[model samples]
Target: MSTAPQGTTGGKTGPARETFSSRKLFIISAIGSAVGLGNIWRFPYVAYENGGGAFLIPYLAALLSAGIPLLFLDYAVGHKFRGSAPLAYRRLNRGAEVLGWWQVLVCCVIAIYYAVIIGWAAMYTWFSVTKAWGDDAEAFFFGEYLQAPEEPALGFDFVPGVVYPLLAVWILTIVIMVAGVRKGISRANVIFMPMLLVMFLVLVATSLTLPGAMDGLNAFFTPDWEALAHPGVWAAAYGHIFFSLSVAFGIMITYSSYLKRKTDLTGSGMVVAFSNSGFEILAGIGVFAAIGFMAFTAGSTVEDTAVAGIGLAFIAFPTLVSQAPLGSLIGVLFFGSLVFAGLTSLISILEVIVAAVQDKLGWARVKASLAVSVPVALISLVLLPTTTGLFVLDISDAFVNQFGILAGALVAVVVLAWVLRKLPMLSGHLNRISSVKMRTTWMVLVAGVVPVVLAYILVNEIIAKVSEPYAGYPAWMLNTFGWGMSIGLVVLAVLLTLIPWGSGSKDKHDPEYEAIRAAEDKEEAR
Candidate 1:
């Protein structure tokens, strides 16, 4: 009767087995992951620090060469196998399976800390909307909530009251995960993403009306070539590009696994990447416009650029809101937007871990979701009690984000683009619906050039951070410990590829794989 659901024939693993097209979900999931904390806080500061307008040069360069290419590569690998990242490697090359699991492991570490920060954003948003605390809100946040001893002191203390909001955020995330991909994640993104876009546009429009907005625009756009000479600028640009685009994380790979066979992988990846870049540009306008207006009025130097984090929102934004008309209402909407952005990204992170559990353990979706949630909640609880939980998030983010993410990305590029012959097949499949095509040489660049650049960035970052030590490492060994952790991840990926996994002799799983395929076919025909 009905010509079978569109994707059902690809097997239980195919996206058609669910109600959402991987293409649609991919866009939602990709956008959800992209528009988060970094977009709002980090990009403006990094640009300001890295020669203002000149930073755009390398950043846009990276978007084309590094960010977009890898995005397509990840989607191709995931959708081709229709399995979790680790299992995708096992299917493609048995030895490479070790590399895949390493990636999955990175996601495990990142997702835990990510949930804690998302909880923090949620608490901020809640406070914003209800005007719950009023004028006392700032004091309550920095004083009672953050437990700083006094204004601007930045001292840390434990607050027993912090656990309640953290628990609320954790529970909310779990509920979303329990809904499964189609109903929960996909549907929510379809709604939230459009709202995010509209709200951002509104923010940008209002910002332009602020006097001295053009001054800020020039500061961001007019390039100073000298910045390009400094390697650190390049490194910052590369890292920001990766972070903003949400590449090299298992999030993209995990999202792609749910994709359908007929979906245009290249097209989808391009759309997500381009859309993300558009948001970054818009975010840049909104942030700098305000910064510019403030600088113009306050007589602050361009060099006196502020650093990244919720501090920008908590301190700078509130200051701005306090000065502007309808300050409280605008502040509420701004932070509320951030809460949604954080939640959407949080949802994707939880989904990656949940998908891994469901596949590996053969658990139902609900159990897998819960199993993943409990452990993360425990980790969040550890940080929730300390005012320096933000500090822990920073440390974990550095080790996992800068070192772990870069390493994971380099490995993925090497394995897929070079060793696995990713581009030729990937390009052939993806180019069918596209105008521009990836050449073999392009794949080689992705495999070779990109990793080399990433490797350079990783090393330089270690030197720069250790040499400077923004917060000052307590001892020499602390610096040593950080390097060891970073290097160990790279070494681990290399070692696993060298070992033998019984030469594929123990069991023939292809029959089981094929049986699943046949069931998928029958389901499609139904």
Candidate 2:
């Protein structure tokens, strides 16, 4: 075992690891990562579809039992091991390095497709001004705007509108990553997260003023007690929580690795978890209020107009923008929020890859950021920003998230908790530095409980995807992008771990890691 001061690693052993300058920045940055595209566009509809107000019970339960618990788990591992995912897990135990790579590759896949969605949002933010979709929103989106082919082939017929903004997004991401953690991530979150919040709040306020806003609010909050009795709703809560908090995909692990040694690990986790959830609830309010207004004007039921994902954001909202008074303002606010939220989350996702590369290659921060991002950006530009990109985006997101992130997470908890039996050690690390101490209950939940839920989710997803073609795509298409991509990620990750680690990573040499190991060894001997 070895020991040395942190933040003292000088040039060329890889740029000295950077940290969030304060707990406040760390918390804000974490929130920014967590409150992403899913929070704004996906959550409102998820809550609405699942029991509405009653869904909160299971949602809160999932947050407490799994979300923050897993949050603590990531913080303890990264902060204690004090490196990127691969480095930290390798330091945890040589056998565990692959888990980190799996997560990094997952982030890489996500970052590429994620940028294109942000590009769409950025374009729509401009489209808001003139109600560009005009009389038929769906027609404009699918036909004139995207110009997606009648068939979803992996085509390279580039859509200039989509490519331009996506290119801009990648360029901006490169600049930020080159800025490093404090200057890049922290500052981006500090600026953008608040702007996102203020903008969304204004959106919600304006949404509330729409003629039938209360109807939407009522629809959102009105609880169906029966939905709770079904297990699927509970599963949905846990599922959404996992994605919403950006766990299991290496983002939190990498982010937590940047935290100061003496930081309040659990306290910060709490702030991030709650703030993300609060923002989600607020998003539900804003989205449904507008939907309610749309329903009112169309003389239709709320359920008829309510939708989620791309439909809600592009098709439905654009229609609302066409109809609502000061319509353009609402569109700007909503789409701007999406652009900001997506960027914050996108940068965080890419950082997992950037940080891992920096640690693995022992490259300087700027070198690693460019080395990782440029190739990734190039891949995104080639694959996305084309006629069939939305299909690619949808399928890649579905399979990668389910198999790559969800399965990787399940494997991580099982290995760390059961196989390696590291929960005690990891829990001890948290209790030592955290404001809120970890009780044995934390171990039970992380080890005994969360895995069961994750296993269920993962199994169901696999069964469903295998049994039926995802999104009704051609079998070959699904096989190539959907199944092939997910399976390839795991194989690639294992291969990546075989590459030799850089000497400059040096996290294993951290004094704190040595101290923790020494204590564990002494306790075992005793």
- The candidate that wins on lDDT is 2
Q: Give the TM-score of candidate 2.
A: 0.96
lDDT of 1 by residue, 401-427 (tens): 767888778777777766776567666
TM-score, predicted candidate 1 vs. hidden true structure? 0.84
Worst 10 residues of 2 by lDDT: 1-10
Candidate 2: give the clashing pairs. Answer: none
lDDT of 2 by residue, 279-306 (tens): 9999999999999999999999899889
**Candidate 2 residue runs with Cα over 4 Å from true position:** 1-13, 507-526
Clashing pairs in 1: 11-520, 53-220
Worst 10 residues of 1 by lDDT: 1-10
